[model samples]
Target: MSRQLAVMMVLLAASGLAQAVTKCQNGSETLYTSASCPAGYRNVTGSMRSHVMTVPGVAKNQEADRAMSALRMQAAAQNQADEEMDLRAQNAFWNQCLVIDYRVRATERAMQTTEYWSYADRYREHADALRALQYGMGCLG
Candidate 1:
């Protein structure tokens, strides 16, 4: 029984030694052997152990990055839409100003050509009111 136990112990130690490996790197090339690395090769066994370690938060961080990117894109699109609406409103306002200016000029011409005093006074009042509106809107500039 002692002889058998001794044999088993020797076999286990030999197996453990056989399982030990040395990892070596030369530039981009890598080698794994049960012996020591050759000259000109760097031992990378410690680095190999570090590479197997699990780093926490890597997946969660990637998900958060994607969420932030999506939010930024949504904000940019909304801003563009708001700008387009503002531009359309400005165009409509300018069109209204142009029509009002034309009416004011026509009223002044009528006041100059009319012979009836009351008609001329009415035209004058209408023109003044249109000019006041234009000034209030900053359209006169």
Candidate 2:
């Protein structure tokens, strides 16, 4: 009976020791079942970690930002082109009006020197044409 009791105590002690085992590995894949690694070995199981996983919305938000920037660039280029074209058209019309005014003054001078009233009539016609064009184009109120 004493021998059986001793065997039972040994089995219980072995089982308790087995339960206390904690698996630990080092950088070289060496495993230890103790509280600390021996000399020349470091504990790798506690400090090793993985990076955080990416959320699904982050990629979508980045794509949306890129698209908005591209659209803004396109709109800015278009607006610049429109302003340039508007300036060119305004300069052309201004030059045309200057030429018409010059013609009117020349015809008036000719009428004053030659005693030909027809030149005065031509001046009036040119002035009227300029005024009509300016009004039609919304340049004159």
RMSD (Å) per prediction: 15.6, 18.4
Task: List, residue by residue over 24-101, the lDDT tens digit for candidate 2.
Answer: 455556543435566666655454322211123334666898999999999999999999999999999888777766
lDDT of 1 by residue, 1-141 (tens): 635643643464454423345678999887765568999999897876432222233456668889999999999999999999999999999998999999999999999999999999999999999999999988987
| Model 2 poorest ten-residue lDDT run | 48-57
TM-scores for candidates 1 onward, in order: 0.57, 0.48
Q: What C-alpha lDDT does candidate 2 achieve relative to the native structure?
A: 0.59
Model 1 TM-score is 0.57
List of clashing residue pairs for candidate 2: none
Residue 30 local lDDT, model 1: 78
